[model samples]
Target: MLRLSRLTDYATAALGWMAERPERIVSVADIAQALHLEAATVAKVLRALVQAGVVESFRGATGGYRLSRPPAQINLVTIVEALEGPLGMTDCAAGAACEHALHCGVSAPWQRISAVVAATLSRMSLADLARPVAQRRHKEIA
Candidate 1:
């Protein structure tokens, strides 16, 4: 099944936490406690996200982490790619040339499907995720 890794899930959670308070710099410990996650794991995930430019780290007592850009500017595709590399629906669909590349009919179709899935993910921005659940609930009720 297509799914994000635990690290990816944590990265998204961390970013979503920051998005909730875009102006505040949240320390790793605080975030871990709030999210009920392990600090070490969150730290590792944050480091990866930092390298991806998804988050910016600060130093000093008041230093912590914050989103590098507006939520609207980020997307699931970029975040997932940052945490897990490219999204692929099949093993051979992962940009690696196969010996049966020319003889395979299923690989081509799978590749096309993967492309569509990736494109759909690319079209959804983090802003969509940042929408408060209460707001979504209200919309649903309406």
Candidate 2:
């Protein structure tokens, strides 16, 4: 089954939390407490996010993290690539020239699928994820 890593899930939750309060500079402890996750895990996730240019980090007494860009500009593909270093269902899909590349028939198809998946993810932004369930449902219905 296709699945994201636990860290990726936590990263999304943490990002969604920040997206919900984009104007607030939130400390790691605050995010952990709000999400009911371990502070260390949240810290790790935040570090990755900071490195990915997704979140800006500050230092000092009131220092905290905030999104580098508006939530609407941060898409799932960007987040996923930030954590996973690019989305690839298979080695061949990631542009790794396999030994069988010359004879492989599925390589092109897998690449196409990967492209579609990436495009779909690019369409989903953090702002969308932060929306209330009722609002999301209403949009879907409409």
Candidate 3:
């Protein structure tokens, strides 16, 4: 099963919390405390986000992090790609060097599936993920 790494998961949680206070400069400690996460982990997550242009970091006594853009503009793919790199769902997804590269039966189908997944992620934003679980629902897959 494909799943995001724990670091990426923490990044989404930290980002979702920050999205709630988009204008505020949030310390890693504060976010960690509020989200019941580790300060070091949050710090690391924020660093990746900053590098990805997903969030901005401030420096000074009051230095912290804030969303570089509105939550609606920062989509899930941006976050996932920030720490995890592009979404390559399979060994054959990215023209990766593999024995299967030559006439692989599943390569084309899997790449198509990966594209659809990426498109879905593009439509999902940080704001959407920030909603409470009870307030968020998904249609059943047909």
Candidate 4:
């Protein structure tokens, strides 16, 4: 089955938490406590995200991490790429020149589907995930 790894899931959760309060600088410890995640893990994720330009890091008594850009300007594709490098359903489908790529029907279909999936993810900005859980559920129900 297709699924995001636990690290990616945690990254999304952490980022979503930060996105909720974009104006506030949040310490990794506080975010870890708030999300019931390990402080070290959150710290690592934060550092990587900062390096990828998704989050800006500040050093000081009152400094912490904040999104480098507005939620609307960052999409799932950006987040996924930041954490996982690139988006691809299959190795051969994502421009990898494999010996069997030209002859494999499965590769062609997966490539087409992967492109659609990438497009869908790229279209969903972080702002779309900033909605309250209740509101999101309401929309899901409708």
Top-TM-score candidate index: 2
Deviation in Å, model 3, residue 51 alpha carbon: 0.7
lDDT (CA) per prediction: 0.84, 0.90, 0.87, 0.84
Better of 1 and 2 by lDDT: 2
Record all residue pairs in model 4 with backbone atoms less than 3 Å apart, i.e. clashing: none
lDDT of 2 by residue, 1-142 (tens): 9888898999998998888778889999999998899999999999999999999999999999999999999999889888787788888998777999999899999999999999999999998877774376568999
The residue-level lDDT of candidate 2 at 142 comes to: 100
Error of 3 at 71 (Å): 0.1
Candidate 1 C-alpha lDDT tens digits along 1-142: 6678989888877777777777789999989998899999999998888888888999999999988888888878888888888688877887877888888889988989989988987888677776774376568999
Name every residue pair that clashes in candidate 2: none
Candidate 4: which stretches are off by over 4 Å? 134-142
Off by over 4 Å in 2: 133-142
- The clash count for each model shown is 0, 0, 0, 0
Error of 3 at 21 (Å): 0.3
**TM-score, candidate number 1:** 0.86
10 residues in a row with least lDDT, candidate 3: 133-142
Residue-wise C-alpha lDDT for candidate 3, range 64-133, written one tens digit per residue? 9999999999999989989888777886685477885787788888889988988999999998998763
Q: Which numbered prediction scores highest in lDDT against the true structure?
A: 2
